[model samples]
Target: MVDASGRQARGEPQGELAGRLRALQELSGLGVRALARDTGLSSSSLSRYLNGQTVPPWPAVVALCRVVRRDPRPLRPLWERASNPLPAPPKSSRQGRPLPRNDLPRDVPDFTGRAEQLAAVFAAVESHRVVSVDGMAGVGKTCLAVHAAHRLAADFPDGQLYVDLHGFTEGRPPLDADSALRALLAALDVPSERVPQDGLEQLAACWRAELARRRVVVVLDNAADAEQVRPLLPGAGPSVALVTSRNRLLGLDEVPPVSLDVLSPEESAELLVRASGDPGGPEGRLARDPESAAEVLRRCGHLPLALRLAGARLRHRPGWTVGVLVERLAAGASEFDTAFAMSVRQLGRPQARLFRLLGLLPGASFDEYVVAALADLPVRDVRAMLEELLDAHLVQQPTADRYRLHDLVHQHARRASAEQDPAAERERALGRVLDYYVHAAAAADAAMPFLSPGAPPTAGRPPAELPPFADKNAAFAWLTAEYGNLMAAFETAAAVGADTHVYELPRFLRAYFARRCGTTHLNVLFERSLAAAERLGDPVRLAEAHSDLGFARYNAGRLAEAAAGYEAAGLRVAQAGDARVAAELALRRGYLSWDAGGVEEPLDLFRLAGKLYEEAGCPAGAAHAAAAEAWATLQLGHREEAARRPGRCWTSRTPTPPGRPR
Candidate 1:
């Protein structure tokens, strides 16, 4: 095919052929070899092209023109006139409808809140070459990633390529790195047969080589882990990659992770409002009570799937009110169970069982030991099972050795547990898990001695196995790993109506999980325990739980609620004939009322508390109460009497000297 000058003879249309070839040969004064040296195309390809034996592909033609010192525009018209056309691609097949998030269509409603997370994710996209959004399952990681990507797509010229690694899709194996690379290669137009097999390194090289000098954006969704993502990274040139994974993917140190937490109340409401699909209508009226709206989000956990489903349910029947929806959500276990259950049912039976078993464990997140206890299997088997369940998205593997499920998913798992085993069988199974954690936590607590209302247990039942407490360091590590799930178990047990668990788990955990660990969510969950106590209607435990919840509420800024709760606890104590605890609650109620703006009813509580304190034979408590009454006297403009009281040994530590600034 080489012509006399060693250039590949050029190919052209039979009729216009001679003229185009004559023009090209004339343009290339140095002929084939010279053009080959300049363009990186082989002399044979050039000669074949010039001698008219073959037509050149676009890139080849562009190279030829560049080497020959000619503008491509002259050949452009003729090239454009050529009859070549690519084969049509196969029609896209539908598998199932993915969650309809507000990440696209420019019109879908985005939930409110996460203003900081939205900004953080956007900053990552704009600032980094590759960013990953990683988090626990149903934490809205994908929503945050996709929303950010679509917002930044303008900067990526070659186009955005979004592929779900399907790493966690039910019943699917993770698409290996090589196959994912091939998919990327195809999107970039490398000839299918030319794609090298088994040479993933080579394929990756080719993919980057092709993508060099262009701006491209690639999103790898639901990756199993870093190994599955390594080859797909575009290392050769300018590009951005956004990877979402259940695994933390710490293996990729440079892939900055946006490990998402659950949505806050505001964000949940915004999502509910959008899902409710109202335009200046009843949805607005419903959203007016963010507390109830937050309750819905709480039941749904503000996960994209759960929130979207909640919206879908509301939208499906416009006649329903928010309160009605709340009534349905108050169904406790069955609220979002149907939808999350189907998501689990789509998984293999083993993975589904693993997911259900995860529900039997405590916490929003947990260590592998809980898995071992629930499955009654070796840690290794539980590890593998957890891995598979995570990849199927039936469970979320946030970090190595830690996993979680959505609230809705967790409820369904509990239902599955209740159904799959005999009552004793299930109780014993769950009891082992509870014991495993409590035992482990107790050991960690003994070793660490975190800040709490109590002292080192000079006592209680001996633990099953002592953690490496002899090594001061290992205890910290174990506690760090197990802390979240330990707290989660307390809330989980209460939610599951686990009678002993409702009260005992908190007592066991409060010693280990504390403010030093930044465990503030405990305050919110204790309120739920109060609700649980109310539901159980046990007078002694109810009063104790109410007092616990009341203190937590006082610390959490719900002062009025705290005051009311303490008052309610006093009533419960009174009914139970526990006058001593009643007096303690009276002191707390006085303090709460005094702090929450009063010189009136709070004055009443403080005065009453003083009488009770005196009657209870605690003079120091009475003196403290007298000090608070003195302050209430000052606030109500009884300053002469206030001057007379002289801060008589304040009965409560709660500061009560000030009144609302008038």
Candidate 2:
């Protein structure tokens, strides 16, 4: 007999009879029309009987068995069983209708973050008929949606329906919209026979009709896109559809989307504490060492999935500290790689390639042009691919034209790149980016005057098609934007033994670093340059490198190191027969003495530097030395002695500005 949805629901007798009929048909090797002729029955009627859609009379069953050369007596009992009606549900349980299926997952008990997001979802559910929640994989989109749905369940008395669309699932394709519609319809208590199975539109119509007068809550979780979610949504009614996806689903109409970011550090720590099982036990220890706790959160990328896993790990290991977990994560241990892989696996080949290359990029963020250069693709293509990544939440664009991978995503990309891309290919890609920055920074540096005029020039062919800088301001702005990246590039080059790049980049960066007052990075950059220069064993280059390092160290208030750097530069300059640079170093050392509050020694050193500068026919240098000697005399509280001893230099020069030697 046919069930309510028009599909066959056969009892044991019907199953046996249908099995005998099908065997007879196959043994006879006849079509339905031929079988009908043999049985003197209409083709449609015989087909229904054989297919178990309907039961036939005893005479018809016998006729079918006889046609297949079998006795009908053995099938009588089977037919009797098939004719009996199926049993009904218990009277108490089947009073009126089935209870509303509350298939929503249990809310996360330690759901520590997203107070604002929860509030927003609550507010949106009140005003909007549909709410879309989207974010990176493992950022708690599903958890947040479930929590919100549970809170809003009372508002919708009809029922709550939940479905996992399997979007971005590792090995399976996303659930199709038609299948999803059938599922939603089934959840709404539509009988199997009545639920439309032909077209998505028809199924959608049935779904809407069911929810039209009711107040149901639908949670379509892990959706593939707007297309998959659109038909599943109930038509305008008291019902609410809460859709969650890794994709942004921007194409959905009038559905206000909420994008979830990683939890704040405070929230992350709180989550860790709560998820630890013993909130006051291990959490109390974490509270005491806030810095280490923060490190643990950072290692987890402040993402809920990672944090939960870390917390679980900590809970299992009672003897382990938060710092222990942080160390493990720092040493390349990760639990969220698979979660990230699901999203990356959804990208097209080009987009995937761009993402891997992004892992090799130097800094936290980059623009399209840098991405293009790194991937060796056209900028237009890179932009389009980046948009795809952005939509997938694999990358984030915090500001216009600048994109960055989340820290955990970056780690995944790096691991993927190392595993999938050849070492040589990665090296080449990194080289291209480093070369670009070196030439680009040099171009920017050219538009700005040197901070220290005596520093040596960098020797390299200008890279072609570099972005133009209209003036010093534009150049400085570009440099400022790329400052961190440039520093990273320098560090990368040094690590790879690219000595020429290592030594040359700082020479170009000195002006910008000084202008920006970036003493900390300057010190590190120049120290790296000195090491690279020493590896090359070029005395003049070493002299200039030491000079740059000395200035950087002096600015950082490392006077002893600064003095040693200048002394090392003086020795190099003397070996290279650069009397002018030697004189400059002597004057710098004299200024250092003055800075150390020594008057007589600086006075003597400045006098010697002045005579040497005069011998080199550098009048400005001699005048600077004289001015500094007079300043030293004034520092000794002998103002008259300072004025008379260096009258000409004092009359011609103003007091040296701060951070500038006279």
lDDT of 2 at 578: 67
lDDT of all predictions: 0.61, 0.74
Write one digit per residue (lDDT tens) for candidate 1, span 108-165: 3464566787787667766667788888766766666666678667777666776667
lDDT of 2 by residue, 1-662 (tens): 34422332333556566767888899889999999999878899888777777676545666677787776655644665565545677898678766787878668788877888888887787788789999998899988999989988988878988877767653235666765675566567666656653556877888888889899998998888988888888786899989999999988967888899999977887888877654665347686677877887877788898787667656756787767766666655454774455456657888888888888886656888678778877777888999988766678775676887655577678889999999999988888787778788777887885322344334333333466699999898788667657766776787778888899888787776555433665787788889889999998888878977887887666788999999899889888766566667777787676555454677788898788777877776777777777765654445677678652443322332113431
Q: Which candidate's TM-score is highest?
A: 2
Write out the backbone clash pairs for model 2.
4-193, 5-192, 5-193, 5-194, 6-193
Q: Tell me, what's the RMSD of every candidate?
A: 33.2, 38.7
Model 1 residue 147 lDDT? 69
Say which candidate scores most in lDDT: 2
Name model 2 segments beyond 4 Å from true.
Answer: 1-137, 140-350, 376-385, 445-451, 454-468, 504-525, 558-560, 578-587, 593-662
Error of 2 at 653 (Å): 10
